[model samples]
Target: MKRAYVLVTADKMSIRKAAWQCGVPIQTLRDRLERGVNQARPLGGDPLLSRSEEEGLVKHIEYLAKCGYPLTRKDVINLATETAIFLKKRPQNAGNLSKRWFVRFMSRWPELRLAKAQKLSMKRAKATSDETVQSYFQELDRILTKYDIKNKPHLIYNVDETGFQMEHTPSKVVGPRGLKLNAITSERGPTTTLLACGNAVGTCLPPYFVFKGARYDARLMAGAVPGSKCSMSKSGWSNGNIFKHFLEEHFIPFLPQRKPDDHVLLLYDGHTSHISIPLIELAKEHKIILFVLPPHTSHVLQPLDVGLFKPLKTFQNACGARMRESPGEVITRYDVCNLASKSFLKAFTPINFINSFRKTGIFPFNPQEIDQTMFEPAKNLARNHWQTEGEEESVEKGNMEKLNQFFSSRLPTPKEPKSHPKKRKVSYRPGGVAITEETIILKIRKVYADGDDAHIHPDNSLGEVSGEGRKRANVTQEESDSDDETDDVCCVCNKFSPDGLNKLNYLKIVDWAQCDLCNHWVHLEFCDRRNVNDIRSGPYRCIHCVSLEE
Candidate 1:
């Protein structure tokens, strides 16, 4: 048809001759000529969105996915419907786009595809940034160079602890269609902690087990591999004392012989239990370099986590499933050691250990081994510094308006206006830090010296309160202040007066109302009151009281 149209326009042939030769209808040829080639349209009717609009929406979806916020099918439909309504292309009463439209939309865009999203915690998503991963590799490189052990894969070791539950998740089975299939498993069981240590050269130390009990039990070691160690913690998890014992007894003894002047690089997560004054001293004494991965990043940077533990858990579950087949038998902690030992032997192979180190870029020291896509989720977190106050306010206001409009159209009018959602406070920390004898020993000693602050805080291991805890402490301090001058501060904004005055004369000058429930004083503006007459009209309630009542 295009050829026919060009032939007729070029005057090489008549419209009827061009149509006959090109096997095109005469009416179609005439229509094409009248409309011009560039103005030709698709065979079907006009689409709901223009070509540019659809492209824009596609870009929006891609951007959200890159920011770790992928939208579902329904979310896309609602977004399209809302966009049509905003553009005056659809009626206000028209509901969201139909499933048929979603199907067609997916077909139109070849780049988009349905996928199952993996679950990742917000903390992990934010922590697995490029900056953090790079910093960790930098520190690791420095340690390897300083110790002159870059080529000595046997000297580089990673140690981490993983937990196994008695109840195993059942895998798929072949069964008759429409019939219920049941897999037997224990009702509930205690978790057993396994501390695993492996080197880049594919050598693993004897596994250590920690069971939950008041005292160590001899029976728990049944069916365990030779030289494996066992101890008991109150929660079946490793603590400072348990870790210290593991290092002193099991790790150091089983570690391969090295030269007296050679230094060993030990990589582990920065768990509170793994850091103590005694542990630091032990590492220093052994000429071992203790390196802690950045917080919440073990999933990406730790060798054991990147390769070994996952398969070990799979084998452990298979072993547990087989044991469940026994008649009227319940798997206990005694059985866990046997099951773990079986899985450990199969999973802790030389190839697995070597692959784990290579995957995490540890032994070979390649920082580029980490995929760039893994860091996309953290891009938004890092971009917070680039957003301006006006941009934030505009975004918040736009979201509020959209929500209010949606609710108003479906439900009855609300009595009171809904408040804005509280913004979550994200605390940032250093990308990574190396724990050396001189860098950490004195800090640990100072924390120990302060008797009241001796307890190890898990997030930082410095015995200091966390960000949320500090916020609570500040609120408590403000509430407990007995000074008369500070008593009249507004509870919501924490200001003395609306005019920013603390003088008693100014307090009277400004219209302040006290909450009848909490007896907290707040400014009239905060209470949604215009003046003293507004407060006199009804009982004044603070924002906090209103929120609680709602």
Candidate 2:
């Protein structure tokens, strides 16, 4: 086009000659120099939305999708109509966008691809609140700036663990209509946990696999991923000891050597397994700064969780599928290593890690990546509307009440079954005679008295067995009649008195032990004996339960 312009003006060539020489149309050459005309060809037909306006709409749609709000076909039409109204266009045609307009709208935005929506838990969506995410990003930015992690991408790493079900969910297959009870061969097996660590530059450390067993199988490790390590746990889950060992034996060894003054930053979740004192101390020794992500916010915050693991799991399942296709081949733990190595190599590309870090607003430190809409779903439950034939109507009062009660209000408490007056164990098993004739008469009377609105508080003394109610039968005859208040019972020892009492109540602050799991209160002395090396300031659990989980 530029050559044609030179030939026509500077060379004084005819329009036809220039067109022929430049292989351009004469009309197009004429329009190129026309006064007060836009150089680019106008899009065919007048559009309801201008180019910039449509771009804005596309951006809004993308934002909603990022926040996990799926837009349906009607949603897009409504959005377009709303946009037209905002632009002060006549509402006649804009009020109801045609199918033709929708097709053209989609064609204009090539980047906006229609894909299946991913399900996000309401709890997780609520946890990723703007305030919480912003605070986390602020703290993360402070640390990254202090360490200058952006310049040293290799030194900034994210460590996360994920578990894979050994069996692959069956894919859709061609079958006759109305077919049911499809029998399919499967390789059902236990779960395996993979602990993966990767840096912003895309390099990943050797992954560690934790399996459920008392002993390690050499065969299982034979064909495993390159540089991958394997260990055994009772529950096939990562723990403080395993995490510490991975950092010491696998992670620290692979880290690039640095000067005495230099330190690397490692990001991980604040799970009990990842925050042990030994792991923290070991990291400090190796000049590794451990940064813990906020609780329940890993879905968006952690680089691995945000990017690497989903594809890794998909590829792992693909590998299993390929194995299944081969005759006489049985997928086993031994094959997981080799198959996983292939999947990891394909999934854990350097670009994925880098993009994940950027998307999470960690490497570049953009705190505003997440907005308020991420929490909108949880903040407001879906409104109910009654659809009759072809028209939508507001929900009726009764329907609205039922929906609101189901979603936002507590359920009605069930009436307790009656038992014999004499203290005895009540069998609640099916076919057991737990309710008596007298109790049935009282129940009928209460139901008739209250009618449909019969209600009882869930925490009422009559509804639930209180601590006092359970121990009343065990109290001594003389003690039961006494007016003096009894000491609080200990949850652990099942005793009615505190184990130790320092007479100087003014000088010492007495702290009662609270069990995080059971929510039971116990004597401080008993908890101290149970957890000898407790350092956590928040909720503390009994040693026996935590030890079993570990």
Candidate 3:
């Protein structure tokens, strides 16, 4: 009896606390003792369930109670009263299990993980329109409608430039490994430069500007092509400089020149260079109305942006690989330009380019007057090796022929015999022309107050006069080194017109010998460009520089 007392208190912590923490129901504790105390971890009486199962049931009951689920008196008893009873239509002869014990037993194995159960696939979101793209379409629609222009094929011209470098390109294409990835190495290869301009109607690819250097700047853009030739200035263009160059040199030329009743509309995407202040100003001056495509839609809207650039790239690579210089210098910008120019002639004939658009499937070309006009605007579009047809496709293949044909024709035409660049007299003060023992030191003490209006420069050259068309007085780099004495005379402030050049003394050809280095059958600076003279007095390396260079 004394040993049994320990189980009554020490064995069950909850029971012990329950007994003293709150005044015990005197009869209840005595009733539990008298009923039974057989479980290993004792509660006051029959728990009617295993300890693990009871713990789980406890959690479930608490959650349901907190969520305020309604419960009947019987359900409450089944939860907390621990009645180990089964009520499955039991008859009087069914074992010794009580109805109460079955209730507790059935509820014991609590399935807590299934508290908020449902199938995963049923939880997907309902369909809805994305506001992002919708807004863009709205804005675009407003613009097109406001301009009173229909959304059709040829009316819009989308232009841009793509680059081909001596290095990596995107896309995992299978090709001739050696030929596919050509770079400027010790061997010669075709350098590539492609300047392109296109719209859904079609693209205008002009003569590619190929040369020695690779770097492209505003000046180079202006120089290789004339401001007049390229119709260019201050800013860049779509495809960067490519579009600007193409538009100025090629596109505009093909386009019918503007007139008073013209209803032509020029549409483009807004690249930094395209919408530059200078470009805008130029557009205004040219009387052109430019419409810009919506931002992200250029992918879907622009014809060239969508499919043409890819094919354009393929031909550029093939042609560029063919331009090889024998192994010393890397292909320069001019080389790329040259290759690109050649590719332009080959890749974008009226037929080939038109065919490319046709193949793209989504092209908006229409047979209706409104649609077809985009492709063939003018009635008498030219036709020749250099001249493009309503659409012309070259049948030529390979390097020499493709390039030589396009390049030769694209070169600036030789000026007429009278339209040659006329030179103005540079007022060289003949400053202190002293004949010292061996050298001549001409230090003219003229006041170059602000160095403005003074042609004399640090290289001891006279300033340039604002000739007929160029802005900012220029010093003719060609004339500086080549002043000769014989057939050439300095007609105005002349001073022998430098060293080797045929002076513009008489508006005609002053027959001198040949330019040895350039081998141009004309007057050159030195007796022979091959000879090397001493350092103290520089030597004329060519027809003009032997004396001037010295």
* Highest-lDDT candidate: 1
Q: How high is the CA lDDT of each candidate model? A: 0.68, 0.59, 0.36
Worst 10 residues of 3 by lDDT: 120-129
The C-alpha TM-scores of every prediction are 0.63, 0.53, 0.32
At residue 458, candidate 2 shows an lDDT of: 12
Tens digits of per-residue lDDT for model 3, 194-313: 335554455453544322233444443332322223322111111234444454556665664444534334544443223333343444455444555433333333445444554555
The prediction achieving the highest TM-score against the true structure is 1
TM-score of 2: 0.53
Write model 2 residue lDDT over 1-550, tens digit each, in one string: 7788778779999889999999998898888766534535545777977675565566556645654666787888876786676566647553578878888888878888767775565546655666667677776666667666757787889887765545555556567888774524447665566778998888888878877777888887776766888777755656567777788889988998787877788887654234433454577677787776665567677788777777775544565476558756666666666666677787889899998888887776676565456655434333232111111221334433333332222212324534422322211111101111234324434543554111111111111112331242211101111011111334444343333443335533334555565544555544355432353556676554455457
lDDT of 3 at 111: 44
Backbone clashes under 3 angstroms, per model: 0, 3, 47
TM-score of 1: 0.63
